[model samples]
Target chain A: MTKSNEYTDSSRATVNRRSFLKGSGAVAAATALHSPAVEAEPQAAANVVSGATTITLNVNGGDHKVTVEPRTTLLEALRSQLELTGAKPVSSDGSSGASTVLVDGKPVMASTTLAMAVTGKNIETVESLGGEDTDAVPRAFVKHDAQQCGFCTPGFVVAVRALLNKNPDATESQIRQGLNGNICRCGTYNNIIKAALDVVKGGV
Target chain B: MKNFEYAAPCSENEVLQLLSDQSGQTELLAGGTDLVGLMKKMIVTPDRVVNIMEVPTLKNIEAVDGGGVAIGATVTLDEILAHPYLEDYPAITDAILGINSMQLQSQGTLGGEILQRPRCWFYRNGQELLDTGQISGGDNRFHAIFGNNGRSKFVQSSRIAPALCVLAAEARVIGPSDSDIQMIPLLDLFRTPRQEGQREHTLLPNQLVTHLVLPPVNGGLNATYEVRQGAGPEFPLASAAVSLELDNQQRVHQARVVLGQVAPTPWSSAAAADALMGQPLDAQAAETAGLAAVEEATPLSHNGYKVQLAQVAVKRAILRAAGLETGGL
Candidate 1:
């Protein structure tokens, strides 16, 4: 969990395009491109970055450097690059909590979050929860049999842990509201809720 | 997704310059919840993705000159929900709670929520925005009933638009430079796309929504009531937001009622407001207002049920704002 300044990938991974115009927000002026094809008028803002670039991500209290494009999501970096595969990819819309990970203690859908956008964030995936003997969330899930297909178990466990970490005394209704982000396609919601409740009631 | 370049500008001028200087298309990324999904489906393929979450100016939530609050565009929904100054505005908070998912509330910004695109199945599946023929013939159980004027049948997809519109919120937009700023009503920002180049919003390709200003409620009480289908992070079936101020006799002196998921934009019903203007909020008055709200709704073949739902939402919103019993969940 100590901070590591090591570059996992030393080379500044080349991106497809290079940086463009940069300036101030309050006092500085900006120039507009003449074309209309790729223009975004809604809320045009970002550091001009194109092609692949090496960026460091701090996940599970450990910093891991990875090269990613603008399109490479946090979930992609966690699973594909860093091999932190606890977060699942159930639905692309990110409504499913299967890709849920806590960034700075907020439950966010990693699949929808671009890796470059969360470069300096504190990410905690399900793997961050210690071994089977140490984490009570997984224990509660096992005791309550909160899985059938088991595809959504890791996410549920992580999401439940996150909820409990924030609200240790979260009631059943609060648990339902808190964990609504994660869905069990196998219809294990009843058991999942029970597991969360067990953890809340100190039964786990 | 396209191999688009990404930019994370620090200042407003920098973002504006990138929006204009970049030859190809550039999309602003705030939460990336809705935009990423669209990009993955190839519904929108921008050449450059702009990350505006880190911009210092767009991150403020402070009290404005009026007793009202001015929230920066990048302020997250959960942050707004937690703000003490907004406690009286249940219309906005209730709508945010109705958003249902913590992930969305944690990541989605007020500007993103107000400016999000439609959830029309056809549109999401890659059909044109004005593809009225397919919308008319396809499965449109969740489509619009009031503002489907053959140009576009897709309903406005923002969950909190009705609430913000009823509050008469003003959006502050920044163009190419600081002098090129425009402050328009929040509702004025939306226009159903008529052409391929046009979008749901009226913003020029270079403009950015810097912040939003909500006028003080003074002695007004506001509430939002939504008729959701069921549990687990789904869009509302119908919704109504009411911002009302009553006279000494508990008679409605001012009323603003706006409906959502029933039209192309947040449909503010003057008739509904008029129905409540002189009367004390009661079951009969609420019923009358609700009926007036949906009287002009022209339901499509598959979705006549939404008219009744919209009516119920209006009735409940008024009753809730008056602190009266809604009588329905």
Candidate 2:
């Protein structure tokens, strides 16, 4: 079947709907503070019953009330539940660092951090930096072919974003040290570093 | 992973209460770097986990007024490397940076790294070597064919422990009851495996390590040099960390030398330290100290090469610390 025939307008609409729902989740979460006390009561009750403690996570100028298990890793909570799949899970073990996220303005392997442990701090993932239109890292990644299987892309992107945010004018050695936690088993370190440098050079 | 109960207490009193309430079945979760990995591997199956991340008193880095820095148990290795005080203490920073891999550095806490289980293939594999209680296959070859003392034949995981020993750091452990804080010399923390089923560190089930206090460097050049087989998911074959306090004329005043991946604990070379104490840090002095450090080394059938490599590392590290070129020593 032709590519055009395979993707019907209905499938396109379904994709759009999913994106809209995700966007709506973000909006609802944003406006949650101004929500009426009556409406907030049910949400708070839901969170308690869902085995999630109320965590005041400030991310990119927004506060989110996410419910999570006590032992739930910050990476798993961000991806599987919050749909913030920016931090990829390269290895179930925390060694590969496909799950790097910033907590309280410091980068950490989210896979090794329990979600509830970071209850009162700020947590930032790749999505916090790159909106759909203004993301330079993802675009440069495509230009440089920094990703192969695409499984490790989100983590690299998030980690680089955190590094650049901390040090926008990072030297090559600094970039290497900053990104040392992340590993690309496909041997794409050169391209990945180049992409990161591209962003730094462009001052993006 | 089994479902476990978690508690984040705010105060030391509360933490003690939890430990007292759930002594045997509970595991303290600091950075969760090693604990989570062990849980995934099924090496540990705790029914309850007590998270001390929220206890602000336990996560601090403060100066001790006299000299030295107190690093909290939950302080990440990245924090230690970036701390301004560590700049004055090169040996501490060198060891912290030697962990090298960013992922491990970010999540591996100073306390957790020191307390982490040995990286034995048999223990990590879990099911295969249940009978032997070792971490590798009984081929006793490949990863296992090294300077193993037969009982818990595994390499120590932390690169920083040896460095800490060289700096004469002290670990402050909070008791299971949380009423008193005990300061133990870092060297005493590791026990021979024969005493306790091959686990080196002497941490009781309910006790928690609150911080590591690094004494001040009086006036010495300190350095750590490591030699790994390769830089991927493997521990070092031989490594050495040396701290030498120098007098006005560059004569050694006090010396601490520690070695890693050669024994179960951070092996201190008192003989090596004694050799360098009153002498100038020259080629002759370094060679004497290096040779003295490994004189009693009993290598496994396949690991005799480690003695030579460790001696070389000791020589290079001392040379580098002394600001001398390592000229084909």
Candidate 3:
């Protein structure tokens, strides 16, 4: 097992998963309020974040204790600190949703979200999907040949999964609106939409 | 983005204290959709970042008395779009939906939406402002036409502000000067930046938007229409939001018409409202109101097309609000 301090390419993913599970229970209450009963954020008046500090980000069902400055976006921490490079960084402005991830089961642009802001929140990335068995999202993408360059595929998959997870009966218009956040420069939108629709209709 | 000190204040009081201490040097991090991009472009490099995402008081969206909605400043655009009650205010919802993309809606907050920076290419490229301390006339195709009297011609980018203005909503603001929160009409919140160096909002750097208090719809017909360059997430070239309260005869009793992307702020047209008052809600009346709305529009060199687009948007919005089938104009 890699030590928590080191974030090398080989052992980055493993380190977070092992350490995260142990500490997740303690910080769960401080995270965002899940639906049906939305509540207030934890009131810790003394918790002033300044300078560089070690932040525990619960990502992909793993606890990633990474040291970062306040300006480090969740996208930066995911790619550089945890070595989860599935989500692409196409635009600094987040006009392209290439760095999308699920925050509290909702699709959010990881590039625009500060890592420290989502310290205790549940963050699901492309890495968490299609674990041992290939999931339906990836299967449909492969079946439809939904990607040309594949730069935006991960974000699309993550976005589609989050959309279906929330609204399984999403119509074509809703699907289009939901996935509109992501952009594919190669113009694979038609195929990508087909892949999502197929998964929605249980075609794959 | 430059390295900055970060603070995720859990309470409103803590945030106020941080703002007091850091003042102009601190930038509040709500959704970070616009601020992060600005930072990456070096448009703004604050010394400290105060992350207000965890402040629960600033994230509430409760229905206010008299059938209005009191939206917490930190409420995300997605949350507002998903609310079932917002359906009554179609103009506001449609305008909010037309902004950016789904991912941006997910990350953008209600407070931040109204306070968006100018998206001019010259400004974004870090080109120096003109000697007059404003954006002098150049290639201003995407700039404002109505508010072009000033040197800065950058069109205001907030899609929500125009809708909110038509709805007659008010903004709840908390500042260091006031012991309690202050409520100002949403329209008064926006200001034309006189010089290039000036910020867009009337609020001070230490002031924070706490909530957006929407007035009761009161059985008004409301709608919004936008003319975008593409079907994708591109910003609108021209957009309009209108609310109409009709009498027993279906004649317009009251009207609030507001246009976007043609001015430095959401431009409200009293002339359009006056033209529609006591007039029969018909195509000709809507057309007249549209024309009246753009009478004051002074188009920049390359943006004469925007005036026509703005007219169409207003006309269509008024017709749609009245449940009239708009024949292609």
Of candidate 3 chain B, the 10-residue stretch with the lowest lDDT total is B128-137
User: What are the fnat scores of the candidates, in the order listed?
Assistant: 0.54, 0.26, 0.50
Model 3 error, position B173 (Å): 1.0
Candidate 2 stretches with Cα past 4 Å from truth are A1-67, B20-24, B127-150, B195-199, B230-234, B325-329
Residue lDDT tens for model 1, A15-128: 111111112231121221111222334445444677889999999898999999888889999999999888998888797879989999988999899999998989999887
Interface DockQ per candidate: 0.26, 0.12, 0.23
Candidate 3 per-residue lDDT, tens place, B172-252, comes to: 776664344567798899888776566777887777777787777888889988888866788899989999998999899
TM accuracy, model 1: 0.90
lDDT of candidate 2 over B113-226, digit per residue (tens): 888877656667774322254433343332322335455555566788888888888776665653445677888888656533334677776666766877777666788887
Lowest lDDT 10-residue stretch of candidate 2 chain A:
A41-50
Ten contiguous residues minimizing lDDT sum, candidate 3 chain A: A14-23
How many steric clashes does model 3 contain? 2
The model with the greatest lDDT is 1
**How much is B34 displaced in model 3, in angstroms?**
0.3
lDDT of 2 at B111: 81
User: What TM-score does chain B get in every candidate?
Assistant: 0.97, 0.89, 0.95
Better of 1 and 3 by TM-score: 1
Q: What residue runs in model 1 are displaced by over 4 Å at the alpha carbon? A: A1-47, B21-24
TM-score for each candidate, following the candidate numbering: 0.90, 0.83, 0.89
Full candidate order by TM-score, most accurate first: 1, 3, 2
